[model samples]
Target: MANKTLVPQAKAGLNKFKMEAAKEVGVNLTDGYNGDLTSRQNGSVGGQMVKKMVEQYENNL
Candidate 1:
């Protein structure tokens, strides 16, 4: 079942999480596309997401 499709149902959840992380870092992100953002801005959003994920994992431990 996993190899049949590329996108999983968790896509929406990830998108929501990305938006939240972007907001926390003061980066503006739209619902559809985000090609207007610079490298640093995009990178910051990803970094923030990873940071939060790590924190969550640590808290669970």
Candidate 2:
């Protein structure tokens, strides 16, 4: 079976969010495909996104 998003409609927004996070963390992410990035660089971008999400959640609480 294939995995699916809980909210499929938000996919586009999430992609945009990821791109913004990459830019903020100094990772050069391009549109379309980005399978060439190093693990460290990708991990940094993901980490920054989680950090920002947590901060936003806390602020809203």
Worst 10 residues of 1 by lDDT: 1-10
**How many clashing pairs in candidate 2?**
0
Local accuracy of candidate 1 as per-residue lDDT tens digits, 23-60: 99999999978899999999999999999999999999
What TM-score does each of the candidates earn? Answer: 0.85, 0.86
lDDT of 2 by residue, 5-31 (tens): 679999889889999999999999998
TM-score, predicted candidate 2 vs. hidden true structure: 0.86
Q: What is candidate 2's local distance difference test score?
A: 0.93
**How does residue 15 of candidate 1 score in lDDT?**
84
lDDT of each: 0.92, 0.93
Deviation from native of the Cα of residue 21 in model 1, angstroms: 0.2
